[model samples]
Target: MGHPMIQLDNLDLKLSLGRLVLNVLYIKSGFFYHSMPEHRHSNGSYELHYIPSGHGRLIATGREFPLSPGSLYMTGPGIDHEQITDPSDPMFEYCIFFEALPSGRNHHERLYGRSGGDSEDIREIARLFLETPFWIGQDSRQLQHVFEKLAWEINTRSIGYRRNITIQLEQIVIGLVRNYTNNQPTLQTAPLKTLDDKRMVLIENNILYNYKHITIRTLADQLGLSVRQTERAVHKQYGMSLREKLLEARLQEAARLLDTTLLTIGEISEQVGYQSSESFTSHFKKWQGLTPSAYRTRTIVPTIQ
Candidate 1:
C-alpha cells in the first residue's frame, strides 16, 4: 500500500488447463522487512516466491534454504514453510498464491479455445507444477520482467489487462515449471527412451482439449495410429472404451459449464458434443443423477448484492 510495497488481491484472475483452472488468490511485490510466519497450503494450493533483491531465508519442512536476489522457489500443498528476511537489506519479494480448481469443460474452453501444441504445452506445464512439491533455484527465465508486467497490468487495469494478466500468469507458470525441470539432474540423465510416452500425452491432450469435435478416427489419423490401435490405447490408458471415453469427456465438460457458466442447457449441450438437448439431458441425467438445468441450479451460487 506504500512505497516499495504493492499487494493485489481478489483480482479474479484465472489460468486455464483445459479442465483445471488456476485461480490467483493474491499477489504481492514488496520489500519484506517482517518475516512471513510458518504456514501450509492445503487442498492442493501453491505459493511461489521470488526474491529479486536483498536477502532472506526459507525454512521449508525443516530444510533451510538461503535466499537472495534471483532466488526462486515454490511451496506446494501441505508444505510447511516460512520466510525470514534479512533486516539489513530486506528482501524484495514477489509472491503469488494460487490454487487449482477442477471444473468441467465450458469455462476453460471459453477462456482458451485454441487447440494443438499450444494448449497441450500449457497442460503439460501445469501438470509439472501440480506434480512438483518443492523446488528452489535461481532465475533462469528472467521471470522478474514477467512479474513487473503483471503488476503493471494490475495497476493500470488498461484495455485487455485481464487478458494480459492471464498471459503473464501463464508465463509465470511456464517459467516456474522450466526452473523446476531444468534444474533437475535426473530429467537429463534419464531421458525418456521413446516417443511413445510423448505421443500418449499428446493423444490425451487432444481428446481433453478438443472433446467437442474430436473423433477416434480423426484423432488416430492425426497421431499416425490406426483406429483400432488408438481405441486399444485409449482403453488401456483410461480403462474405458473409446465411446465411453468420449462420453466421459463430454459429460465432464458439460458439468463444468453447468457449475461455472450461465449458458443455457441447449447451448452447453452443443458445446460439449451433444447433437441435441434431449440427448444431452438424457445422458447427463444418467451420469449425474440430474438433468442439465437441475444440475446447474443445484451447483450455481447465487450472487449477493
Candidate 2:
C-alpha cells in the first residue's frame, strides 16, 4: 500500500505579522518510506517542513541537507527540492504551506507589489526568506508539540478548535522565524506604538462582538482613549473613520445573518444595531448597491455544485 498521508486545506487560518498577514493554505503530515519527486512551489508560496523522527535527506537547489530527528527547514517560492527516506528508518514529517501578504483593503497588493511601496519591515522579511531560500536547523523551540496539538485539534473538532488551530499555526510560523533569526538581531517591524497592537485587537473585537450596542464613547472608555483619540486610532489602522467602521461592521453582520438565517429584515436590522428597518435598508443599499432583500436573495439561494 502507498504511504499514509493526512492533509488539511480549505481552512480560514490567518495570522498577523504587524500590518502584513500570513494566510495558511494547506498542511500535510505523514511518514515517508519512499523517495519523493522533485517539485517547486509557485511565486510567493512557502513550504515549511519539520521532521520529528527518523532519517532522510533533502536536496534543495543543488544543495544537500541531512534530515534527522528535530530537523527543520523551509523551502520558498521557486526553490526546487525533494526528500528521500532512508528506507530503514522512514522519516515522519509535518509541513505547512502559506503565503504572506497585505491584509484589509490593501490585501489586493502582493507582499511587495510592483509599486514597491510596502513597509520596509515586510520587505526585509521577504528578502530574508528569498535570499536564504533554504534553511536547515535543529528545532530548539519544541515546535513538535505545537504540530502535535495542531493535528489533534484538527482531527478532534473540539470546541474552539478553529481558533486553537489558528493559534497553533501562528506559533509554528513564529517558531520557524525564531529559528531562522536565532543569531540575528530581532527583526524590526513597522512600529505599532506601545500597546497599539493590543489596542487594535481590542477595538476590532469590540466592534465585531458588540456592534449592536457599541458607541464611540463606550469604546473610547474601554480603550482609555478619548473620543478624538479613538477616532484617530480607528482611522489610522483601518483607513476608515469610526462611523464608517461601525457602519461596515453592522452591515457585514447584517449580510451574514441574511445569508445564513431566516430572520426577517427587521430582526436583522435590530440585531445589527439599526434602529429601524428603513435605516438598515438605506445603508445596505448605499454600501453594497443592494437592499437587504436583494442581497439575501442573491446570496441565500442554493447553488448546484
Candidate 3:
C-alpha cells in the first residue's frame, strides 16, 4: 500500500545565518504542496523536517517510510527524497535547509572533534532519526514544546525573527543530540551531575546575586575553598571558567536590557555591572559581532519600521 498523503496549510518562510542561504518552511492546513517534483540537493547541504501533525510518507533511495505526527526526517548531503501528503487530512510540518561546513579532519576526528560532535556523530544521529520516523507525543513534552516554539518562530516574521528562528533550530539540534546521547549505552555514563553539587550551586547563586561586585577571592572565601580550588570546581562543572561564566551572565542581562528597555549603551553597560561603557562594548562585540549600539539598532529599529 502507498504511504498516506499529507496536506499542510499557511506556509511561511524565514532565512537565517547571515542569509548565506538558509530556508525555513512552515506549512499549515490548505497550502500543503511542493512546487517541484522529487529532487536531490547536490550542493552538499543538510535538510531537516519536523512533522507535528497529520500523516505522510517519505520516499527516498527507492524505499518508502511512513511519516506520522512528531516524526523527524533528515537527509544529509546528496540524498534524494520526496514527500507524499495525506489526501484527506493534510500534515503540518516545519522544514529547514542549510549548508554544512567542512570539519577538516578524518571521519573519526570529525566525530569527536567539536563541542557539538562531528561527522560520525551526525551519522549516528541520522540512524536514530530513521529508526523512529514517528515520534509519538508520548515522548517528553519538552521536545514537543521546543518544536511548537520553533514553528511559532518560523511563522512569525517579526524583527530579528530570522535570527531567532536559527537559534530555535539550533536548540532543536542540540535537543536531538542530547536525547540520542541519553539513550546510547556508551553515552549513558553519568554526566558530571551538577544537580547535587551543593558548593557549585551555592557559588552560582551567590555570583548571580552579587555579580556586579564579584571577585574570585571573595567567592572562594564564601565557599570555604581556596581561590584555585573554587576556580577548578566551577570550571569542571560548568565547562567555563568562573570569570567567563560571570561575564556571560552579565552579557545576557545586557542583551535583555537592550531588547526590552530604552536604556542607552552606557546605561546598559553600567546596569550589567561593567564599570566602563567601552569595556562593556568591547566584551559585547567579542560575543556578538555588532557593537552595543549597532546590535540594538539592527534588532530594535526593524520593529518600528
Candidate 4:
C-alpha cells in the first residue's frame, strides 16, 4: 500500500449527483485487419473507443473523423457508427460500454464490493459519464496504462476480477476527465444524446415525487417543452415510452403505500392516481399479479410471522 501515486490534475465539469448509477457492460480490446461493417449499438448504453495503435477513420452520424493511435471517441445510445481500418497498418483499440442504472441499489452494491472506501470512488466514476464529452483525441500514456490494466484484468478472470475491473474503470474515468478538462483538447464530439441531463433529472424527480398528480401536459409545460417533444425525448434517452415510465412511477408508489400505509386498497389506488378502485385493482393485478389488498396482506404477514 506504500506505492506512491501521481497527483491527478484538477479539472472542472459542473457535475451534479441526483443519483449515480454506472454499470459497465463489457470491456475488450481488438485488432482490426480490415474495414468494419456498419453497425449500431441497440442496447441503449454509453460507449467509448480508444485507439492506441494504427490508423483509421471513424464514421459516426454520417460524418468521418481521423483515427489514429491514442484517439478516443464516443458513440452514444441508439447511434449507428462504423470504423474503417487503414488497411496496411490496420487498427487496434479498446472499447467500453456502460449503462446507467435507472434505479436499484442492491445490484450495484453487490457488483462493486463496497468495502466502505468505494462509495466516493464510485461517485467520481459516475461524474465521468455525466460530464465527459464525446470524441477526445488526446494521447495519454497514463490512460493507456489504465485501459490495458482493465483489459488484462478482464481477460485473465482472476478472483475478484470483476471488482478489480470495476475499480480500475472508475480510476480510468477520473483520470481521463481530469486530463481532458485541463488540457481542453480541440477535438469536437458530443454523445448523440437527445435529452438534457438537468431536465431529465428534474422530470424523473417530479414523476417520483408527484406520481399521483403529474400529468403529461403539466410536466411538459413545466419544462417549457411541448407534450410531443417531452415524450420523444424521454423515450430517446431512457429507451422507454412515457407511458411506461409513468406506469412504473405509479406502481412504485402503490407498492410503497401498500407497505407503509394502513389505507384500504381503493384508497391506495386513488392516492396513486387511479380513479376507480376496481380499475386500480385490475391494473395492480396485471402489474404485480397480486391485488393491492393481497400485496398489503402479504407484506404484513411477513413481519407478523
Top candidate on lDDT is: 1
Off by over 4 Å in 4: 1-18, 42-44, 102-128, 131-133, 183-305
Best-fitting candidate, measured by TM-score?
1
Off by over 4 Å in 1: 1-4, 105-119, 185-305
Ranking by lDDT: 1, 2, 4, 3
Model 1, 77-106: lDDT tens digits are: 556666778889888888887766645455
Estimate candidate 1's alpha-carbon lDDT, on a 0 to 1 scale: 0.71
lDDT of each: 0.71, 0.70, 0.54, 0.61
Tens digits of per-residue lDDT, candidate 3, 1-305, equal 11222233223433322112223322222224532123333222345666666776776655666767766655643344556677675666655543333233453343334444335545555334323322222122255566666556545668886577567766665565455445441221112122222354366455555667878888888778899988887676556787887887687668657755798898999887889999999999998898988888783322110
Q: Which has the higher TM-score value, candidate number 1 or candidate number 4?
A: 1
What TM-score quantifies how close candidate 3 is to the native fold? 0.39
**What overall lDDT, based on C-alpha atoms, would model 3 receive against the true structure?**
0.54
Q: lDDT score, residue 73, model 2?
A: 86
Stretches of model 3 off by over 4 angstroms after superposition: 1-36, 103-111, 114-142, 154-163, 178-305
Shift in Å, residue 275, candidate 4: 53
How would the candidate models be sorted by TM-score, starting from the highest? Answer: 1, 2, 4, 3
For model 2, what is the alpha-carbon lDDT of residue 301? Answer: 39
Task: Please write out the lDDT profile of model 4 over residues 71-174, one tens digit for every residue.
Answer: 87766554555577887887787776555543335534432444445476555445445444344556564678787777676667699976776678777666
Work out the TM-score per prediction.
Answer: 0.55, 0.52, 0.39, 0.46
